[model samples]
Target: MKTHTLLTVQEATALINAGKVMALAGDEALLRQLPKGNWIAGTIPYFIADEGGVESRERLYASELTQVGAADVEIKTYTLDTIKNIAADGPDNGYTIVILPARSAIHTEYANHGRDYEGMFIKPIVGWIAGVHLDDLNRAAPKVVDGSAGAVLAAEAVAMHVTLSADKMAVIHILNLFRQDPDADVITFAETGFSASTCLVNGKPAVLAEYLAAKRIDLKLPLVADYNGAQINTSFQGVDPDGRTVHFYAPVFPGIEYRQAAPVGDYVAELGALADGAHGGVQFSCNCILNYLYGELQGRKTGDLYGPATFGEVAYQLLNQTLVYLDVRSVS
Candidate 1:
């Protein structure tokens, strides 16, 4: 593990200004110190702003940023739309830059607003979202927002810029991890009886219930249960030939009523056996939702809204356990 030192606002700002990407600890203090005009993404506070304020734009100080979330450490901001305006369309690709609603103007307004206003107002303000575009993937021209617009406009600019940067970093991390394990198979399971329709596996595509019915087994099996461990009996559904779609009784896990079919213990054990060689191993990644569900099952709750830190801890535990199996295999 790398030792992480918390950086002050000025130091963080300077690092960002120097064009260095920062891996933040995802704490409230770090979120507040995030420099304006730089992109950042991690769990931050999210909330709706209260009406009534001084109507002045102000740069958020470290102290003010801490108090911005619904709870502590969460930064509540707005979702802004990214608009690309093309001036001249051609292979040249040179474009003009325009900031809509003007982020500076919005920040100024928020500063003007007195203590009566609660929460960060992020909306209505539109601007160019900033992030490193891999190749020509990001060819859109910069957006233009008039500075004289409302606070929402400026908030939008801030949100878009920060989100784009954060998203870019996330993509890079994911890709790097994938590169480290190119042949790893992606498995998915969907829970039945959810209003959302279908569940996705590894974010590739959704599996509908109707498709699973084709492979259905005529048996009254335990479908799912809620967090209370109450089992709901449902018809045993068939799985796809690829072993991806599984229709089973829903588990009592809260929020999710249906249980998606997952690989049985035997399958996992077999894979572990294969990777048992002295130098071989396996890597696994999962959606944070799974960690949240497990935490709920374990009755562990970290008040942090984003819950990335909690997920990280869970991941470490799982990884260590996987290594233990590999160690056994090597010795055998």
Candidate 2:
């Protein structure tokens, strides 16, 4: 397993300059200094490392991909349409690092179909959405790099798909603390859609106003859907009063019913439990920004787990308030 680390600009520069395949997270200014190579990067200032949680603009959170017995690695860039063919043509056993600018049309598009691509993926993929500080989230757009050109402020996404050795295989998984609030009212929708701002409840297709009015629901607690035993989360962002629509941080997939998640308790302990089980094989990982704020993770350690705290996490699909990770193991 590869361990992630915090690096100084000079240190990171030396590594990238040496042809390392790195996934970077940090403030905008420092990420631009590295010489372009086999790497990808995103903007964010929060992380949970061996040193515990901390936010910084001067340093970078880096995950070295060239480790874990990768005999060869290839880095590539793509627009939304171009990326659709990755699995048909990419390495048979590997992982892709995806970094998309928040709120872009491509971001919205990918959020809806990330899983649809999974069927075509010859390799596993684990990635996240780039983000700015909470205060500048709406004002500052996130950035991504492909190394062929100068670091770019992405209008869409910049992905690095790596090809590992034949003896090694990439594996992807997610860890979620949220569970369905069984005690809460069962909410059902009539229509099928993705990224829906409004949906019918008990045959009434109004906004969340009525639902919010009747139930003592916590907006911070996301809607959870069980997919093949995996708890996928979608969070409530806000509502449009005029349109009677409710916005979501991630898409609510068509035809899948969802239930409000129960509030999480003792996140540090829960994180500890998750890390204890998964830390050994994790090569790349990212946690949701919501977990950091809602769990009060700053200045706390999640065992040996380390990675950026992103706006959204991707593990075959866009997810909210979850931790996603990738690992590679020898076939023999």
Against the true structure, whose lDDT is highest?
A: 2
TM-score of each: 0.25, 0.91
The prediction achieving the highest TM-score against the true structure is 2
lDDT for 74 (candidate 1): 14
Relative to the true structure, candidate 2 reaches a TM of 0.91
Q: What is the lDDT of residue 222 in candidate 1?
A: 24
Q: Global CA lDDT of candidate 1, please?
A: 0.24
Where does model 1 exceed 4 Å of error? 1-14, 23-25, 44-259, 263-289, 292-332
lDDT by residue (tens digit), candidate 1, 1-332: 11122334565566546544222322333344455432333321111011111111121111111111212111123323222111111012111111222123332222223111322111111112211112322342212222112122224322211111111111100100001112222323343121223554344555544434543622222233222542222224345565554432121222343443232234223323432233322111111222222223123322211111111111101110111110001222
Give the root-mean-square deviation of each candidate in angstroms: 19.5, 2.5
Candidate 2 structure quality by residue, lDDT tens digits, 1-332? 23389888998888877767678889888888878776778889998877788888888998987443324666666677766655554566677777888787677878776666644544666789998988887678888776646657667577766777678787887888889877755455654333354555545565565576567668888988877777788887766665456778887765776788987778788876786664445678898888888778898887666799998997766788888888878788
